[model samples]
Target: MNTGIINQQGLVFLNATGAPVLSRADSRQMRAHITKSNFAKRRQRISQVETKGGESNKQTTQQALHRRKRSQQKSQRAALDTNPTELPTTESPPCAPSLQLLRNFRYLVFLDIRPTVQDPVEKAWFDLITSEPVVFEASLAGGMRCWGPDKESQQNADLHLSRATNLLVDRISCEQVPSDAMIGAVMTMAFGERLADNDVAWNVHMEGLINMMQQRRHHGVSSLPPVFRSLIALDFMNHLLGFPRFYHLKVVDMLSSHGDQVLSKLAPIPADLSLLKTAVDAPETGHMGQTSHGVEEPLERVRLATRALREFNDPYVKATSRSLEIYLNLLWPLLFTIDLESVGSELKDAMSEFRIKACPYMDLTSPHYILGLLATEKDSEASAWFLDRIQGSVQVMRQRGWSDPLSVMKRGLVHEPHIHHQFTALLDDGINGLM
Candidate 1:
């Protein structure tokens, strides 16, 4: 049996019909070629479809853009229709905002956050940009950050404050019943005076505001908005400082409502003092009677509240708290001054105690220091001390990157006899009725 060798490509197997057949390798090549051709055709079809879809998508995008442009135009037209005097336009390049406007913006932003105006206090505060002279001047007064750094700005602010006071007086006299806006304006003026450390002026304004609210029959704290509650909290603190009780509502009632939470957190006066007193006196009043030990209990609570103030992360808040603490200590030397037998008779003890305990770098030229001296009946000394510290205060504030270095010194300047006539009156009449 002789077997003949055949080339792999040429090798073939005969079918049952005895016909010559393609080798397995040749069959595989044919099938592969067909499959590749089919794939190429399928890919070409897909590419064509994708191209058409892309064109359709481009058209759709163009249509959408056109519609948006039309919608914007319609909005502008509507705005134009609403306001005939002002032309409707898109947001233009912001030119430099006026200083007053900038200040107003900052104030509005501040009002939106905590430790300022919280809750839906009223819609009236948001409507302050009206033509009302009281509102305008009040805004200028409240915008403390804008004008505190310089003498010129300060003078301008004073002018605005004067105008605001005049306007407020007129409004109060004219209106049969006080409006919320008017009330807010008066409160704002009082707050501004407080910030300026014009104790006499602040009390005066605050008294007037209370009178106005009383006239409005807001005897109940619940009748007023949360804004007034915050005001009442301040008044309560003022009461603790020896001012007559301006609020009829108990401190507990005010605290129970939504008010300045920060003040509540750090108040020197506890909310339930009256309740505690009542309970201690009449044990049958409530379950809290057992807890009401004595004045020491309330005093301990006050000390605890003040601890949170010391732990404040904000340096500004801490400094303000320290200043307030020093003021409280300075208020009643007979009651609070330190003695050999007891820790002190006063709220924070004698000025000597603070001198020893206070940080050496503390701003002695601060409003707290000068006012403390004035309250202690050391006017001549306070004036001299304030004058000496004016330069130092300015330098320190500037070093701290404050835009309003002069404001820090000027806060105490209002107490100078040469600077404010009220200071002279304060000296003559004392804290009760200087205004």
Candidate 2:
């Protein structure tokens, strides 16, 4: 006999006769329904927890990304704060006009090489012209006058010129020994005056410059800077134009000794000069070569000229040197000597040969080439014809806005007390010597 408790589907019993009541299928079904309901409830609770965890994980990830972004911003700010030079300042960036003006000045004065920082003199000169407002304006004036000769540019140039002059005068009074920058400023002013065609003003600046340079020499600064090379070229032009030189003979010689070195510093010799081989191969020539009845001289003049030309890597420097060579070697003797009969024909021939060999390598736009033309012409007609060609070239240069230092230095051979006058006298009057 089974003694057990049995319940109906929705009720509980205290006691019952077991086997008949417990064996019902509906009771077991009811229990199974209750178990299925409990499992559904548990699954609902677990899903709710997982949904909350997902939301929390997304928020945490977003917060981490935001922190990282803010840290990067702080780092960037810190970098900017530390680098002072990179920070913005009150000074405005160089405008197109100033940059263009500086470019013009560079092309006119430095022959487009722009001064190298490796050279102290060039660096000093470059800094003055590009950084100092007054000196920059003064330097800019030359380019302005040369490029277009516009009235507005001229007016601006004059304004800058007056200011620069005052600055130079004030500085000279204060400093016992003028600095290189000061000398450069004065040189710039003199260049401006020259462009303005103010001989008296230019002369005043030159005199001041001479005194300053002399003081430098006395202070044991014997080596002249490369910037002085341009001054020397200008001085040579002055000599050619019959103006008395301001530089003393000793200074000229001292500087002359280092001229090649100075010029080599200005620019690099091109790695591949097509004409270099041609110049090197040109036949040995001159009176020196005429020795021993057709045996070439060990010191061939053509070779010497080629070597001299190579010494100056820049075309501008070469032109300046060429003009100086003509002035010293040929013109000086011809102008100062008492007798043409005493002047050796070999001297003229050597110079002519040098000119021929050196001509192929020169920048034809250079006014220095005109000096060569003038010195080598055998007759007045040829001189006049070349003069006409030069005038034509000058007109073209003016029309096209070209800047050549020598042409400006001599005022294109058209100004009063020009070199052409002396040249014409020598050729037309059959004058043996000016002295």
Candidate 3:
């Protein structure tokens, strides 16, 4: 059959017989078929277009990329918040001004005092001189004993000098004194007797007294009467300088019961040129003020304490060690404020002696006084000397297997300049020596 458009209504097809056929359908009917077929085809094309548009959207791809980025960021944040070791953390607190001051002062004192000791004996002596009292009585007695000679003679001569001395001898002879106490006492008496130019017999007497004080200080015996201790300290100071009653009383009254009180008392000591000059050039008495410097009477009062320290011994030694420690602790800052250069050498020697001989038994606070004095000095040479000595000491300590040697060195370096360089050099030398 030949199919062709017919009357614009439907498709006509020729039958097998090639004759004209008159059979035909209504126009509306044929038109309906045509419309239906066209509508179906158009629907198919619309569906194709919609499918293509849907395929082109790409929303899923963009969403997936966004999701991956978000996931990565979440992982990074988790990692950042996680602390591995499970250790607790604390916020750093503010620095304490007083503590900083003390540290700076200690560094300066170490620098000033590390010299003048050629041997371990001097070093040990220095340690004993700077220790704090373990016993309340020792502390109280020390304060009183540090005043002047008159007070020492009045209060401590009978108890500490005579009675304590006898008891100490019996204990020492019987070997009843504990080893540490025995060593401390022997050292104390040796140093004390030396200061007083005492011979062997006096030294023997001093040994016992020294032991008793050391033991008491170490153990912190609080039963000691405060008044008795104060009187003992004043008497010790008096004996040290042979100062008269009036001068001793004046100085004794100035001593305070606590560290703060001692520091407050130091505020009034004169720092004028006259005082400085007298301290520098005072004859045979030297810094002791025994010479006729013709200075004000009050200035002499200030000097009395120093004089006592220079002449400290067992009979009147009650609190001189600790008392002087407190006194020096307060006095250096005042003196440094006035004239650092003149006082620097003397301060250094005094502190060094204390650190080396007395620090192990005495208050560690005393060294800070020397440190304050060193800070006041402008001399680089002196500073270098100080640093070198500290480095050497640290090395020695480390070689002896001392714990926290580095800490000790670091402590020495704190608030100091160019210390790292000095320490590095010293450490290298120490390593080489060990090798």
Candidate 4:
């Protein structure tokens, strides 16, 4: 390699547009002035190279450049393993666009791929730089150019998303034995849908993720941290809102036992999530009977779980109220399914409070099955707002992907408010499928 060209290659772009530039030597000096911890080593390396008095200037510069590159690679690897903000200052220009793409993806989803990633994990998640789903890849390329400076990119994003949605449905249908790459692709597409303002696509992508979780849980670390934090919360939210849960509560137990377990039991004395399943089953699995001696067993289990949750407190923990909120909300469905008339009076205030607290985690529209059911009984502001939202979304619901809660809301109980028989017929199918 020509020494002149290698020296020029060391110069780095100062901004996203690659307009401003700083000579590699000048940037290294500036970085040394700013950060003593890392640049100190660079300075020491420079000194050692300088002290070798017999060496020619060409050899000296080459050695110094090699030392600098090595240091940067070391620091970059460390930063990626932990906090990426601690990135090396000596980044090369060749990798700039690819690096920028990664930064955008990370900032949006917060899925940093931080767990003990092996070959399989790396191939799936990290390979996005080379091969992401067409949808997300287009959406990202579009995002980079979508600002006022580029109208074509903005239009391209729309066309890409429209085509992407169609492609995603086909992708989901075909991926029966989903690989990690497919999971990562689904995750990427979901976030892209969020960015593009495609709620219907976003919701559909979310359902695809849950399906992947069910299909692929046993392949690797099934109870991934996000699985506990995100999916369990989703199940609880839907369950509480009076929709059948799309995921099982026991997955929380499975997550608690294995995987990147980020969730902590919030109940000061948290009950086993299995207790939730046990409580529901105690009264009746398929069909619940009238409140008799049999009712006390399930009710007591509910009381203990509720009491633990109500008293829960751990300031430092994430999703502190999560376990409590999801649990309390779940009780509404089980209790109401067993006896609807009294459940309304009992869970009225708690349900209202829960939607307020848990709204940050899942889509507000998706988690309000209970709200729709309650709307059938009587109209409150919460129920009224939900009804309006659902009414407006009838078109989206009619789509093939929005089958679960949409079907329940439309052809069944919520569609005919006074119809008690539809509710009874749904007892087994709704909770099992939904949960």
Using TM-score as the measure, the top candidate is: 2
Model 4: per-residue lDDT, tens digit, 103-214?
Answer: 4343222323233333432322334322324434433433322221234334434554554456556666885555444554555555445434456765676677667667
Per-residue lDDT of model 3, residues 1-435, tens digit only: 432113243333322332111122322232243345446655665565555555755344446446656775565345335521111111111121233322322222222234245553333223232221111112222222221234322253223333334434565576442333333334333333432334564445344444444454465531222222322343332232232111122233333332323223333343432364455455643443333445445555665545444453321232343333333333333332334443444444434433123222122112223243243343455544444444455454343344443332234344333433433454465433211
lDDT of each: 0.43, 0.43, 0.35, 0.39
- Stronger candidate by TM-score (2 vs 3): 2
The C-alpha TM-scores of every prediction are: 0.35, 0.41, 0.24, 0.35
| Global local distance difference test of model 1 | 0.43
Off by over 4 Å in 1: 1-124, 128-131, 144-146, 218-222, 234-435
Residue ranges of candidate 2 with Cα displaced over 4 Å: 1-125, 214-220, 233-238, 243-367, 373-397, 400-435
lDDT of 3 at 222: 19
For candidate 2, what is the TM-score? 0.41
Pairs of residues clashing in candidate 2:
none
In candidate 2, where is summed lDDT lowest over 10 consecutive residues?
354-363
TM-score of 3: 0.24
- In candidate 3 the C-alpha lDDT for residue 198 amounts to 44
